[model samples]
Target: MIKFLSALIFSLLIPLSASAAEYSDGNGYTTIKTPVRTSDPNKIEVTEIFWYGCPHCYSLEPLVQAWKKDLPSDVDFKYLPAVFGRGWLAHAKAFYVADLLGMEDKIRADLFNAIHVERRNLNSEDALARFFADYGVNEDDFRKQYDSFAVNSRLSQADAKIRAYGARGVPGIIVNGKYLVSAESANGNENIFKVVDFLIEQERQK
Candidate 1:
């Protein structure tokens, strides 16, 4: 059910388009050593490796949301919380728990807002529980699932994938698992999507 709902939400995130002009090498992204292939050959997978506590990710949130509004239908975007830093795994768990509870889309921006804008301390389980409860999510239920096997499994998979992408920092974007782009490479938040769109076009032609 989780995967199905996630797919449905992804399918509706953006628009549709075809190929584009050539993309120069080393402009804004790096090709992965072993490209991570997508499950659906018909869809180009775009994954963002981010941590909620990351200020850069927070700043890029609005731009990414705006960019996603018009994403080509053949592109599928999903968030992969980077758990490389201290206390990051806990936050990753929160993300999965939110998804499990069907509140990911509802609270994703709010989580970023709470931490960056509202200055809420959601670093720990107790703190996050209270934060989620404010949204009417059952505290007990959230806590239970937060530590469940399913969430843990997803976190484990995320750890492996982040390492595979060779992302030394947060807020990395991987297009079709073949290219990696970040603020440093893209030069700015807004341009990251431009690089992604270019990569998606590159993949579409294949």
Candidate 2:
């Protein structure tokens, strides 16, 4: 009786362990990380490679923001606007322009909303200039930097990184440049963060 009572108490006190299971459909589809990490172990970098026009990415912004806000002090988070096709280049340029202007954090969320909710077409130089003007950016200055060698180079690098990460779609998370977590693993934006936390813990031990 005492052994039985002790076993029951132990089971009640100990939480169930989580299994490392691969969640996927049968169509050669599986969740993968975004922004494939380069060999930079000085920091645990987490990057989300996304496009302004991607509905999945748009839906993920708030969840990613919350995860970033609560991130461990050692973790670094970055947003890389993915330019996977010709249609995405203009938005990528606009993202680089905002980065050059030091307005990335200030305008990133609005950019997402402008494309996803406001139904604004930011996929062109002219439209981007107009959008910036609304936000008080000098059109000439923005135009100068938008097509600058530096911005173009950065956009190219971002493209390469996205491809290297093997991301077939948006709303993906790459942890420490090795593990990827995406909505494909689970059905919700919050699940991505949960996978991120899991990956971080896994990396922490190594």
> Tens digits of per-residue lDDT for model 2 on 83-149?
7677888888888899888898888889888988899878888889988998899899889999999
Off by over 4 Å in 1: 1-23
**Cand. 2 Cα-lDDT:** 0.76
Local distance difference test, candidate 1: 0.86
Cα lDDT tens digits, model 1, 119-139, are 888889999889889889889
TM-score of 1: 0.87
Query: Which parts of model 2 have CA positions greater than 4 angstroms off?
Result: 1-15, 19-40
lDDT of each: 0.86, 0.76
Alpha carbon deviation, residue 83, candidate 1 (Å): 0.8
